[model samples]
Structures are given as structure tokens and as C-alpha cells.
Target chain A: MLRREMNAPRDNIVEIRDLHFSRGARKIFDGLNVDIKRGQVTAIMGPSGTGKTTLLRLITRQLRPDHGTIVVDGVDIANLNKAELYKLRKRFGMLFQNGALLTDLSVFENVAFPLREHTNLSNRLIRHVVLTKLHAVGLRGAADMMPGELSGGMARRVALARAMATDPDILIYDEPFVGLDPISMGVIVRLVRRMNDALGISSILVSHDVDEISTVSDCSYLLSDGKVAASGSPDELNRASSELVRQFMHGMADGPVAFHFAAPDYAEQLLGRDSE
Target chain B: MPRELWITFVEFVRTFGALTLFLVELLIQVPRVFVRRFRLIVAQVYNAGSLSLVIIMVCGAFVGGVLALQGYANLTRFNAEDAVGIFAGFALIKELGPVITALLFAGRAGTALASEIGLMKATDQLSAMEMMAVDPIRRVVLPRFLGGVIAMPLLTAVFSMIGLLGAHMVGVMLLSIDVGAFWQQMQSTLDLRDVSEGILKSVVFGVIASLLAVWEGYNAIPTAEGVSRATTRTVVLTAIAVLITDFMITAWFLR
Candidate 1:
């Protein structure tokens, strides 16, 4: 089924090895391992509270794994100093769930931010690059608008432009289709595919929307209980034999995932036990 | 020991340690402001300084008038009514101006900075900056810190000037005390040392207030309620820190 590619070579851009992370007493990722191939669109899908976001944060070096190594490109990020980590970050771009545009900056300035911070480009050149990036997202006309003035979809598009402004080797999108209309979702899917092919950059998409995941991803991983329970092409995921996989993929109500919390019998809890 | 008291003591030590580390980080990033972030520093200065002029002026005028009126009443009993100017000048320049202006700045610009940074964190702007390889402390906090430090002494100076004018209006113009005595006594009592002392106090207070505000904001939990709590903490901690700092600086220099 190609579910576990343990023997994959070292050509992958990102590799996680036996990763373990926890929040206080709550374990999130346990002995998890994943590889992201270069110039491919990979998706991480899971039910609610399955640590999809945490995985992205670990890859970005925002949160260190409690017990393992995350290697980006070739360097083990856990050992990188602040300067080295920042230098490593330049090789990647990320789009947050809510777009995360700087509220004080206009759309144009937001797109120009990375260039202004990292490059010594002239103002004329910066303006040229910023407009070109915004134009790619079809938001050039809204360049002067403030983030508060943008619709959700527009803000997401602007964030996309800003993320790609640095022309990073890898792009990470956290919930790209979240809260989007169908048309907007379609636009994002097309853009992700088009940008991946045109820019020849790898992408890691974190989402639970099955349709969007299948449409945009070259490969997919389904995280369950702090582990990748199943991984394959989108079609293979739809035909996964595991009951947990079927429940999540098909959005079943009564399956391995309980509809209620684990508790004593409902009727006994509602009525006090008779005194013995 | 009471559990609450032990908890409070631990919290105090933790906060003190965190603040010390924050100040160290800020000092490390200070030079970057001049090299790459001059425009941001200028904007922060305008925000923290120019926007604060009116409040400082109005508060200074009222405080000076009250001082002059009370000093005259007390000195009248000693037959030293002409000493009103000296009293107002010494009190305003040596003690009241810097301390009161700091308190007001904490309430005004300090709170504003805290809320702004808190909102940015809640909205994931800080994370986005991190992803872009830009350090938020160097890009955001440094400008505000420098701005506060630059603005504090200037604001204190303005406050003292307006206060003296108010004192003059009360002592000389209204009470018909000899104008010559008023100016003469003020000039004789105040020196470059006293003015410098006041400036130094204000600059230190500025650093404390601005740093505390930004620290609270940056560490605030990313939520609406969390941002509100952080803003409240900025005002409370800034006020307390300013008063304590004023006392320490005053003891070291003024004495």
C-alpha cells in the first residue's frame, strides 16, 4: 500500500525522525516520522485536535520536539543558534490560518515586508517585486487596502502573496481552505497547484477538508492519536481499510471516534445509585 | 507560611528574572535600530512623544498652580511669601516633573504599546514575522523603547516649563508678590545639576515603562481576554516600577 516508506532516500527536503512532543500532560506527537519530498504538494489531514498544527510548528522550529530531531534541508534545526535558525527560515515561507497580515501595513507593504527586511533592493525594485507578487495572487488592485478592509478570501490571497515574496524553497500553508467559500477554495487549490509547478517549490498543506486535500495534494498523511495512521495517494486514502481512517475520511458519525466523552453509564449517572 | 503568600513570592521572583532577561535582550538589539530601523524608531518617537504633549502640559499647569498656592499659604505664616517661586521651581524640576510625567506616560503611551503588541500576537503577526526571519524584538520593541527613552526627558522638560509658568501666574500676576523676588529666587535655587538629575530620572523611567509594556504584550496569551489582562498588567506594573525607579534614582543622585 506504500503506507510506510521507511526506506525512502535522503533526497527529501524535510525529515522528522522519531519525533515526540507534548503540551504539559497532553501528548501530541509520539515517535512520529514524516518526510516531505522536494517540489511536491503534500497534505497532512486529521480529525480535530490531532496535532496537525503542532507538526507544522515543529518543522518551522517554533516549537522544539521533546525527544527527536527535525532536519530542514540538511541542518538539524534543534541545534541551530538564533542567527542560524533565522537564516534557515529564509528558505521557507508560511501562511497562517487567518492570514496573519500586519494590521498596520497596507496589502502592498505586507507583501514588500520580507524583501525590505532581507534584501538590499532599491525602492523601485522593491515596488516592482511587490507588485509582481501581488499580481500573481490577483490582488494587485487591492494593494493599497488595509487588512481590516479585506474580505477573508482577499486577506488569505494577500497572505499567500506575502509568503511567496521571498521566493522560498518550501512553503507551508496551515488550513488554506478554512472558512473559504467554494469559489475561493477552488481559487486557492488552483493557485497552490499552479504555484508549485511554476515556482518548483515544495509545499506542506495542513488541512482536514477531504475534497480540498484530494484535489490539491500529490500525497497525503492522515494523523491519528499522535501518529500517522495511514499515508498514501488521495485515492488510496479514500479506500483505506482501517475503520478509523474510514470514519475520518467519510465523516461518519458513529465509528471508532466516540460521539461523547468516556464516562460512567449515562442512565446511572443521571440517576443516583440506590443505597446498598 | 500561607499558600497565597508563597505563591506571590514565587511569582515576584519569576517576573523579576523574566524582566531582567528581557532588558538584556533589548540592549542587545538596540544597535540594530539605528542601522536598519531608523524610520520605525522615528514613527514610534512621534507616537510616544508628540502625541503626549497636551496631557503633560495640562497636568503640569494644574500641579504647579496647586503647589504655588499651598507654598504661599505656608510661607505666609513664616513671613517668607517671596519663597513661593523657589518652592515651586525646586519641587517641579527636582521631583514632581519627571515622576508625574512617567506615571502619566505609563497610563497613556505605555498602555497603548501593550495593547498594540498584544493584539498583534493574538492575530499571529509575531509568528508571521518569525516565519519571515525578522525578529519582533528588534523590529517592534526596539523602536518603542528608544522612542520612550528619547521622549521622557523632553516631556519632563516641557512639564517643568509649563509648571513654572503656572506658578508665576499665581505667585506674581495674581498675588502681586514682587516679580523680581520670584524670578531671582527661582534662578538662585535651581542649577544644572538639579535639571540633569530630573532628566536622568525620566530617561530611566522611560526605559522601565516601555520595556515592561512591550514584555507584557509579547508574552500575552493569544486571545482577547489574554490581551486585556496583559494591558492591565502593563499599566499596573509600569506605575509601580516607575515609582520605585524614581525613588532609587532620586536617592542616588538627588542626595
Candidate 2:
């Protein structure tokens, strides 16, 4: 199935090798290696600030790895110039955590932005395309409304519509289920699967929702300390041997992970007469 | 000595210095910015132009009325009531109209724009735009700047006309200056140079106001609180810049 989706060649749709990123003196992700096969939804699950979003940024070329190679569609994203990078970005869609639609523009205009910007299509054609995409996301009636008016779920869908407006080859969702109610979460997961199937576009879903991840993901990776600590099908992850993975997957708080409270340390110092 | 005062002074310097550096960098990379994102000029024009007509009319009308009263009062004391029309026309076309209109715009659109863009930056919209290969300056700042440029002169023109008319009404109706005499004086004093120079000042004001607002908005840090601070700074600085530029241009032209 992955082979058929690649269509053009055997190369991975998106490949990352030994990618390291640091903010100032602290290293975030180290020697992170991952591959996203064409036509598969790859779920990346990790603890907070373990660099899930950073990984997405690196793949999309919004960030550059200190030392590594990210080849997308057979071209190394690192070497692409500004114009080439722009062209490359056109092939991928990204759903942001907070549905970052332009507040000033109506939903119609928001969705039409990419089409109007990248193509010289006539206004009529652009309107048709925008409405079609909006309808696909079940938001055709909200076209005239501003993004500020929509519910969070609706806004996310609108953003999704805008992301899919350009009919990108790959779609990336950064924490799509964050801050969402269960119903909304279900709707988004279903939409992700539906869109992937309908458009035949490859997707990378980065999330921490274990239940949704298990249900929606074809293959999943456990990212820890900037490396793929473990990776397998969801079923395999359920049967994995890593303690950290098990602790994280079950959402256990009192295992090896300690919740450091500064107050306890201060209290201990005072009670033990260690204070100067 | 108050530490808060010192902190404020330091912050002021930092913001001004950073803005200056940003402007210099913007100037240096202008060619690249333009080449990659020229359509922003059109967008800026549209953003600034839309919804400006009503505010401009209201402000201009009141300003014109006040100009007429002040000019008439001062001129009449000198037994120069005959020059009421001259005072009103020359004052507005040469100086008061453009400066006042721009100051108003700086407060209204400038503050709102800076706050909105600054908040967007805080929320990571700019980052998303960058990821999409969209140039924020081109997609966001350029459109707003161009909009200000287009909107300002039109607003100034409205201001000039309304101010002159208010002066006319004051002179003819209230002060008993003959309509014909007033118009005659206006015809003589309101030369093409006066109109042209006012336009020139307004254009410069437009550039400064838009640049300052957009720059502050673009470089806003922290979060929404940062956006609010940037908005305040944009309004204050742009207002001062408008006043200073107004004086400099007036001195250069009138001298």
C-alpha cells in the first residue's frame, strides 16, 4: 500500500535522519530519525515539551536541524531557496492547534487565500473552489461568517477546510484534539481519516490522546529526549516492553515520573535544619 | 529616584532602538521583500482604505469649523476680517488638515492594526504564515502600509474641504464677512503649491504612521500583553511623528 502511494518511486514521502535541534544551550531533540510513508497516518506521541511540535516544524522546513537531513519528495528541504521552499510547502497542509484563521477575513476569504495567492484563477472559479472545500468540511453555510463567530470545533473545521483548499499531497495535524470535547475530538479524528481516504493524501498526526491515537493511527512512534525511543503499530505499542512507553501510554502519574514540588523541598530544608 | 521611572525610560530606549534597527533592516531588505511579495502593496491599500470615509468626514468637518472660528477671531482683531477666507484656506491646505487627519488615523486604525497584528504574532499566526511560505511583511504589513498611504491623502483632502467650508460658513453666516470677499481671498491665498505641499506632508505622514504601527505589531513579544504595549507605543510615537513631521515640513516649505 505504501509502495502504491509513493507512485513515483520507492523513496519515503518524508524522511528524517539524525535530526538534532537545540534552543540556546539545551538540546530538545537529538538524533531523531523517522519516516512517513505515503498514504499512511503516522502518529507521534510524546510527553509535553518532548518536541512533538518542533518535529512537525522541522519536517515543514519552518525550522532547520543543527545536523541532519530531511528529504521531502526526493529533495532535501535544507538546500531549497526561499522560492523553492514556498513551492515545496504548497504540497503539504497543516492544521494548527488553535485554528489560526485570519480574523479580519470571512471564512470564504480565509479558505480562498491559498488559491488566490498561488493561482491566477478567476474570482468565479476561486469562489466555486472555496465553497466546495468548505462544504467538504461541512461548513458551506458559514462562508460569510468571520472566524471569531464560530465554535472551537467549527473553527477547527474551517481551518481544516482552508488547509485542504490547495489540495495538498501531505497533511500534518499538530495536536488536533487538544482543548476539544470528546464529541469534537471524535469528529476531527473521523474527518482526518475521511480526508486521507478521500484525497489519498499522506498524513502525520502528532497527538498525546492515547485512545484516539490507538483508534486513528496506522503506525505510532514514541518520541522521547529527541529520539524515536520506540515505534510500531498501535497493537505493537500496546504489547511493547519499554517502561517509559508503558508509563506514558497508561497515563500513570506515580510510576518513575516524579512530580517535583518546590514547596516540599523548602519544607524539608526547614524541618531538617539545613537552612542557613 | 524611582526605579519604575528608570525602567520606563530604559524600555522606551530599547523599543525605539529596536524599531530603528528593524527599520534599517527593512530598508536594506526592501528589494527582496518587494520582489517576493509585491501583492501586499495592493492588500495594504485595501486594508487602510476600507472603512475610513466616515471618520475622516466627521473629524474634518469639526476641524474646519474650529479653524474658521480661530482664524476669523484672530484676523478680525487685526481688522483683517477681509482675510478670514485667507486664514481658513491657507491654514487647512498648508498645515492643519493633513496633520490632524493623520493624527486621528494613527489613533483609530493605527492602534487597532498594531494590536491585531501583535496579538496574531503572540498566537503564532506569523509563524504559521512563515511555514506556509507566506511572507508576513508582504501578506500583512505591506497591505496595511499601502492602505494607509492610499487612505491618508483622501482623508486629508476631505479634511481640507470640510475645514474650508466651515470657515466659509463662519465668515459668511456668523461673522458677516461677505461670501464673495471670503472666496476672493481664498482664491488668492489657496495656491496650487499650498495644496500640493499639504499632499506631500500627508504622504510622508502616511508612510511613518503605517511603518511605525506595522513594525511595532510585527516585533511585539511575550503575548497579548505585549500586543497592548505595542499598540500604546504605536499610537504615541505615530502621533508624535505626525506632529514633528508636520512642523518640519511646514518650516521647510513656508520658510
Candidate 3:
């Protein structure tokens, strides 16, 4: 019943409305709308360079939108001062694609990082909390090991442990499955689902692994050309008739989305007028 | 050419303004960092200070011996070989010590700080800290800045002391100058003013070197080439700034 009730209209943990963003002269998001429902794994699926990571940045107020409002739990992050923004960010646990564990610190200390910074927890308490989080990610045995020693998946798991140490209300994964071996991918996929339901917190995943996204996501949005090409249950997206959605879901080499970048005619460039 | 000159001038002003702002931000974060980040600062002192000790000492000894040998040869022309001690001491305390130590600091600790921070930025560790509600400026940058600034004056003092001994080794033991005359000349002529000048120069150089190191590292483009470039810039900028400031400080003291 609790999971079913997440489909209600007013349950969004983050709401983006009429979003507009750009990097220099190039547009990123144009009137994009997205909702991350409370207590569910919502995936933002897109082709590469569609600004999925940028969307995550905007959600956490790392970059301000050109025009539009992002409401994270009824607070418009556009106007938060530095102190206020940091306070708001305490609610989020973000796992970067490369894991981003502090190299100077060991696995345990890396997980203990946020706790040490934000809370005045005793050393014993911090250790307990760190080990607990590490255990949750199945990395308790690797607590004293340095980050450089961990495999990519293990490093990602350690990063996940670090991210969750502060008990954030929202867990964000930025391309979590990139370059992961299938076993590690399955482990991460299971953890993503388990963490969301087990903790009863929201998870916003930015990924393009359609199979993993379909398996783990409660709802998915496919983005193309600065807009949500389609959004619904993965099955619904799979069943959709739109060319962009079909091309992305099926991983077609060429479709409405051309493999070649937009440029001057290839023949014209080859047979240059300058040759005369 | 005019356009290029104008562009260079504009870039200079922009970097100057940015560096000033960065210095101010570190100052503002001072109380917060010092309050709880003392261990981090101490560790950085060990990193930027003790770790750089061997290089600093070796160079100081060699520089002192060279100065003494040269000063003795010059003084011998006028039968004033005793003043070799004064010459070496004056040069080491007032000019060479601070300038050379700062240069070495730039080469040793400065490169370390820049490359470490740059790599962290490349790996997104700094961004991760930011996302976790921890300010990297307070946690990472400020402590290192404090470490270098604290270490510089001390390192300069150590360098001058060790250089005097080096001068003694060459001038008194090897060159066979009258030991009493060499010792007396240095003790009397090398007044508090010379010591103060050395300390002042070192502190200033420390601030400049440390500030530049952290600035280049923090603003480095997050890539291997970028980090390498940041490290190179940290060394180059700090070396140039130390030399220019040495002349300026010496001139000011003379006036």
C-alpha cells in the first residue's frame, strides 16, 4: 500500500518545472519537467551528453538553471544562500560515477567522512556507524584498505557506503552501472532497489543501461533533444510507439537519432570549392 | 601587438583580482578552520615542512659554502679574509636564506600541494566533499596554506643557521682563516636587523608561495595534463614572485 501510494500526485521529493539550462552557447535542458517520487527508484535515462548529470547537478544546486524553478521538498533552491544550500544538500547522498572516495583516507575513514564533518560523534560511535554503513554495502572487511587498492566495483561500493553514512533522505547515483562487470552490475542493481525500499527513502538514478534501468526503476524517463522523449513504467516505455523511445530502448545504430553529427555536407567538404 | 598587450594586461588584472579574493576567502575561513582543523594543519606542517627538510638543508649548506669560498677570495684581495664570515652570514640571513628556501619550498612542497589537490579535483573528491556539505576550502585548502606559511619562516631560520655552520666549515677549517676573527666578525656585524629582514622575507614568501600553490591546484582543470600544468605553474609563479619580492624587500630595508 505504501509503495502503491507513491503514484499519488503530491508525493514528489523533487519537482522540476519548465527547466531551462545551457552550457555556454549550447542548450542542455529546454522546458524539461521531471518528478522524483518519494520512496521509489526513479531513473533518468538518456543517450550520452543529454545533460543527465547536469540535471543531477541542478537538482543539488551545483549549477543554477538558466530559467525555471527546482523544488526539492517544497524549497526553491535557486535562492538558498551558501549555508542554506549546504544544509539542503545534507539531505542528499550522491555517488559519483568514479566513486570519488577520498584517496588520503582509508575505506572506513572515507565512509566516516561526512559523519566527522557534520556531526560530533565520538570515535567509537563513528566507527560503529561507519562499519554499519560499510556492512550494508558488504565492505566491512575492507574497512582499513586504501581506495587505490579496491576494484572498480568495490570502490563504487565503498563510495555508496560513504554516501549513505549521513543517512540522507535522497540517494542519487550518477551513471552507477558504467563499466561495471555483470556480477557487480547485478549487485549494484540489487542494492539500489534494496536501499530504496529498505530505507524508505527516495533514489534518483541517472543511467542509460536500459536493461538495468528496466529491472531496477519503478518509473523511467527517456530524454532526447533537450526534452523528455517519453516517461512511464519501463514496460510502458518499451511498448511506446515513438521513434526516439524505440531507438533508445532497442539500441539501434541509426534511427531518428542520426549516428553522424550535424555538419556541412560530407560530399561538399570532400569536393572542396577551395580546390579550384 | 597592441591588442595582444591589452589582452595580457586584462588577464593579469583578472588573475590579480581572483588571487586577492582567494586570499580574503582563506582569511574569512581562518577561525573556522583553526577551531577544529588543528590536526589537519599539523599534518600539513609535517607534509610541507619536515618532508622538505633534507632538500632545504643540503641546498643551504652548498650555498653557504659557495658564498664563503667566494667571499674569502674577494676579501683576500684586500687582506680582509676575516670578513668572509660577515659576508657569508649577511648574505645568508638577509637575502639568500629566505629566497632560496622559498624557491625550494616551491619546488618541493608547492608541487606536492598542487598535484595532490589537482588530482583530487580530477577524481571528484573535492566535489564529493562539497556535496556532503563539507567545504573543501576549509577542510583541504586552508590547512595547507597555514602549514606552508608557518613552515617558511622556520625553514628560513634553519637554513641561515645551517649556512653559517657551512661557512664556518669552509672558511675556518678548510681555508684556514683565523677562527676568532671569523667568528667575531659574524657575531658583531650580523645584528638583529639582518635576522628580522630574513624572517620578514620568508613569511611574505611563504604566504605568496602557499597561496599560489593552493590557487593553481584548486582552479586546475580536472585532468592529468591540467594537474601537471598546475604543478608547473605553481613552481614557476612562486619562484618569480620570490625573486621580485626579495629585491623589493631588500630595497625597502635599505631605504
Candidate 4:
């Protein structure tokens, strides 16, 4: 979440240049360039199926782009091997869309996963760290419960706790507000800000909720047509000159963006035939 | 024709590279994966192994009853009903224990692993793991594999022993085959190879089931439909692999 520093700002932590990715024959991202600075929340927003998640995958090195480079913390993520990539990923934390907590594990184990995987901390220390993360996310009491027992909001918070368990340098949130109620959304958004401020972690939030994104992100980028079409502060996007960006931000239907529910002449032909 | 062949070869190489990369990733992070989820592994062992106990026992006992019934009827016709205990014990230890149990476990745990991981992949849990720097194969696949490998031999041994006991119960109390005679026949015919073959088959089946489940789960694509497909494939492939291994082991050992 966005947390402004009163003095000086940290340097950029993530940089991508001319990134292109293809899944089979489908081109998902092409010639995409962006920079995610440290100690700030950058929201990437787009419609569904516009490859918002794919872009995140590329940044995280889960899916390598067909062309171009992604550098995080002065290292090219693309050039790293599996082992090196695993090490690099230790710097990253992610809150998935569905709060992907392992169904078989308790909430305590879920939060402790990253710590146990990457560190040699004693069980006592691991417990302390896990409970601290849980407490940060306001779920310290639910540590022993199974994922299935938790509500949707609780599960997402557990996932957030697990994401931060290892004290990652970078945090990525994929649609944190998608399925939550207003209260839950408020809790998560607040926790994101609180955790970022408390831990000073860099974050990239991918969301479609413009209002929430506006409230939480210092900078926002609109991804469309396999590229970042517009990017700036929320005010910049709200008053952007680009027609497409304006249509998207204001949610206007009578713009260049079409629904494509029918072919150009299908509706007209159907109506004419019915009249005849 | 040459161009097509070249394309096919390149595709094969790419697939091989992906698999090799996955294996290398798994190998590197193995310790972390196991250490982190040791509790889950223990829980899975209890869930999978304990829940399957009654079925294993029932099948073993029922199979033993049938073996005794059939062996008594056939061998008595030739005035060699004394061989009933020997044949039943040898068959149970050599073939039924490993093969039947593997088939059962594949249907139970193998399918479950495939579907569970597949669903996780479908829902982006695998991606979540990646972002968290958690190794899915080591954390998820390896533990389930270990469970099957560890549980299979124990379950099979239990099955074989119980089956033999069931045979003995019927053979002595009802069939009137002398208990002393039965023990003598088994002592004379039973060898370590017979018992070892079943354990060996179980190990192979365990490896195959785990590999299949992990492979399918790793390659799972979008949609819960893909997970369903992986579950079916895991069961069928594991069962078939178990049968093939059983035949190979039986032939090598029996001969």
C-alpha cells in the first residue's frame, strides 16, 4: 500500500523494458515497460483478460517473457537459473486472488511456511515471527484454525500474513478486494498500508477497484493492448487526455471499447428479419 | 519432411528442458520443502494411511478366505489339499500384497494428490508459492510421495499377514487342514524373495504414483476442469504402472 516518506524517496526496485510474452499463439504482453519504486504501492489496473495477472507473473519471474528484460534490485531476473531464481523470489511476497492457503495446514503453519523454508530459525523464534505477522494482519487468534474454517476475509488475511512471514523486500497483491465485503476490504486495505509503513516493504498492487486503488496507491498504471497506456498519480489518470483511459477510468460504455457480444450486422439483421 | 522433423525435435527438446528445470528446482530446495511441511506430511500420512486401514484389512481377509476355499477345493480333488497354505501364502506375499494395495492407494491418495495440486495450480496457489519462494514439489509433492512410499510397504505387509491369518483361521477351524501341516508346508516353500518382491513392487508403485501425481499437478493448466482431468489420469496411469511393475517383478522373482 502507498506510504509517502516525508524526507527522501527510495530508488526504483523493479524495472522492465520492452517485455513481450506469448502463451501458445496468444500474445499476452508486448513491449511493456514500467518501473516499480521502493517504499511505494504501484497499482496495475485493467479489465479482465487483459493479462494483469500475466504481467505480475512476468515480474515475479514465474513466466519468462519471450523478449526483453526485468531487473529487480540490480539483478536481471530473466538471467537467473532455478536456484538463483528461488533465492531472488525470497525478496518477493504475494497475496493471491483466492488467498491460496494450503487446505491441509493450520493458519499458524501457513504463515510459518516461508520462514521455515528459507530460514534456520528455531521453532520458538518461528512461532514468534509467525504470530507477529498474524497479529499484524489482525488474525493472531485464528492461528490454529484450518483454512476451511475461516471466512473468505480471514483466509485472505492469513494469506497476507504468510506472504509477509519471511519479511520479503517486495510484496505483490493480486486483486485483494475482489471477493471481500466492504468491512473486510477496509481491513485488508488498512493492513496493507500498515504493514508497508511498519515494515518499509516495496509493494505492487494489481487491482480493478479504481476507488480502492486510488485510495491506496501512490502511482497507478493502466495496462491495455499489451502495454501501459497511461500511468501517473490518481489525479493524473482522472483527468487524462487519452480517450481510452478516460473511458476506462470513468466506466463509460459509449466509447471506442466495444463489448463484442455480436458481429457488426447480427443485431441489425435479426431485427430487420423479425420486422419482415 | 525435414523441416517438420526439425520442428518436432525442437518441441521435444523444449519439453525436456522444462522437465529438467523443474527437477533441478525440486532438487535444490528439497530440504526446505520437507522441513517446513513436516507437520503436514505427518498429517497426510495419518489421513491417508489410517483411513485406508479397514479397507485393507477387509480385502486381505476376504481374499484369504477365497484363496483357502478355492485352494482346498482344487487341491483336495488331487489329494494335495496340504499345499493350500503354501500357495496362498506365496501368492499373498508375492503378488496380492503389493499390487492390490498399490491399486487401492493410487485410487485413493494418488487421485487426491493430483486433484489437490491441480486445483491449487488452477487457482494460482502454485504461483502464490512461487512468489513466496516456497517450493511446491518439495513442500507438496515430495511429502505426499514419501507418505505413499512409507505407507505402502507397511499396509501391504499388514495386508499379507492378516490375509495369511485369515486363511489359517478358516483352514484350521473349518477346513480341517491341520495347523501343524500348514506351517510345515509354508516353511518348506516360502522364501524371502517372495516377501521381498511385494515390498519392492510397493516401492516402485509408490514412486510411480507420486511421480504421476506430481507431473500431472505440475503441468496442470487453467480451469478446475484441468484438475479433474489430472485426477482421472493419475488414477489410470498409476494403476497401469502398478500392474506393469507387478508383472515384471513377479516374472523375475517367480522364475
TM-score of chain B of each: 0.96, 0.85, 0.98, 0.84
Q: Which candidate number maximizes lDDT?
A: 3
lDDT of 4: 0.82
lDDT per residue as tens, model 1, A162-258: 9999899999999999888888788889999999999999999999999889988998999988888999899999998999889988999888877
TM-score, chain B, model 4, is 0.84
Candidate 2 C-alpha error for residue A104, in Å:
3.5
Check candidate 4 and list the clashing pairs: none
Candidates ranked by lDDT: 3, 1, 2, 4
- Candidate whose DockQ is highest: 1
Tens digits of lDDT, candidate 1, B1-255:
699999999999998998999899888878867778888988998999876889999999999898889999899999999999999998999889998998888888888888899999999999999999999888887888888888888899999999999998988888877899998988998899988888888888888888888898888998999999999999899888888887888888846
Give the poorly placed runs of model 4, Cα more than 4 Å off. A1-10, A122-125, A261-264, A268-276, B1-44
Better of 3 and 4 by lDDT: 3
- TM-score, candidate number 2: 0.83
For model 3, residues A141-177, the per-residue Cα lDDT tens digits are: 9999999999988999999998899889999999999
- After the best TM-score superposition of candidate 1, give how far the Cα of residue A176 lies from its true spot, in angstroms: 0.4
* Candidate 2 lDDT, B1-255, residue by residue in tens: 699999999998997788777667556656665676666665666666555666777777777777778777887788888887888788788888888888888888888788878988876677767756677766776666666777788878887888778777767887788898889978976788888999999888888888888888887884867888999989898988888888888899869
The order of the candidates by TM-score, greatest first, is 3, 1, 4, 2
Q: Model 1 Cα displacement at A34 (Å)? A: 0.9
Docking quality of model 1: it rates as: high
Please provide TM-scores, in order, for all candidate models, with all chains considered together: 0.95, 0.83, 0.96, 0.87
Candidate with better DockQ, 1 vs 4? 1
